[model samples]
Target: MSEDAPTRADGDRDLFDPNYRAAVVDLLGALAYSELRAFAQLAKDSELAPTLGHTSALAILAAHELRNFKLLTDRLRALEVDSEEAMQPFVEAVDAFHARTTSSNWLEGLVKAYVGEGIAQDFYREIANYVDPDTKSLVLAVLEDQGQADFAVAAVRQAIEEDGRVAGRLALWGRRLVGEAITQAQRVGVERDALGSLLVGAPGSGGADLAELGRMFVRLTDAHTKRMERLGLSA
Candidate 1:
């Protein structure tokens, strides 16, 4: 990941670069909607919780997603972009991802929240490196991993400790989540040129080459694996 992002010294000139602006808007929009959907899904999944304590924890997690969604939407508005309009292009793809990865049980839902959200955050953080400093800061801020890691690991490990059989099923579930996430991401890459430009360059900027993109994938995959391991689940 490049830390040599254009500083404020580059001034507003780069901000006015149409391609960069479009790409950033597209990125923000996709993130905004993803957060929004995560909140909705988390809220719904909270109902499947076995106890009030678990339900409350899941609701808190949903709130975190909503907060990130608000940050992204606010950024979009500051750029004079309609948040909904910007997110429109990604609606179907994101929706499709969640639809295909729906969980059949409470533990599966938790695993999805842990593994799926972790992967999405990793991918966005990777792309942030290629963007300007301001955008990179916002992306990083919105992606703060929070305390979900500890919660996921404790809950999952406890479940596995109680019933060793669950480990095998959840390991497969984690793999399915990774696969579906990759499928949707590739679909979006092919369908959204603006988002794709983040990897290959918008127009003027020398964006990541094929090798760089490959490395980015490796980073995301490695991060996902670690996240799954943290949850006591297989990647």
Candidate 2:
């Protein structure tokens, strides 16, 4: 987390599952790290847009991610988890994932923002439900507030209307993003089994089995590809 970015402070008092405490802490920490990095990436990538309208909206959206990061970080601290320590190792994992799949242009950036943010929201929604009610409520509340996905989707749709051929490259890029996501997920499993197990076993979240998670991942990929097709972009 950036030192200058304002910390989001929420009530520390929330019911939680003691057995799954580490998983919850680590999940929030990892999620927070992703948000922080995404903001930084968007802030940089937003300038790549041709229009001030696109750049300005992305910058403002990037700022909002900081708020969510602060909220998640504060929650980690309240749980007596070391926010920095928990988030540290993941910095590389999440950052590397983004670095490897960076957008080549503004439209690529927006498409990435759309597909990436949507999947992340879905993943978090699944994870949050498995935790406790307070954590669930807080996570759900935060989920409701993310506008980046909406903005990204709209931006891409508009961009597609301007140039139809951009779809093939962007769709390919989305596939690459999905590929890296799966690779990093495997990395996460090796690095953090407990969290992975929680993801696998926590009721209906993420997966009932590895096959289920695989199925869900394929669904997300197909949805992204469909998004491309809908935009007059070829998969």
* Top candidate (TM-score): 1
lDDT of 1 by residue, 1-235 (tens): 1254334464333656777778888889988988999999999999999889989998998999999999888888777788999999999989999999999989989888889877887878877877877888889998897777777788889999999999999999999899888776666665778778878875567578889888877887898888888877766
TM-score of each: 0.92, 0.81
- Put down candidate 2 lDDT per residue, 1-235, tens digits, no spaces: 4343222332232234443666777777778887788788889888898889888888898888888789888877666677898788678778787878777788777766666655665566666655666777867876664666567667777776777776677778877766676566556544776567565775433335778777766765676566556545565
Global lDDT of model 2: 0.69
Candidate 2 wrongly placed segments (more than 4 Å): 1-19, 202-207, 229-232
Cα lDDT, model 1, residue 151: 75
Root mean square deviation (Cα) for candidate 1 = 4.4
Instruction: Give candidate 1 misplaced runs (Cα > 4 Å).
Output: 1-13
In Å, residue 136's CA in model 2 sits off its true spot by 2.0
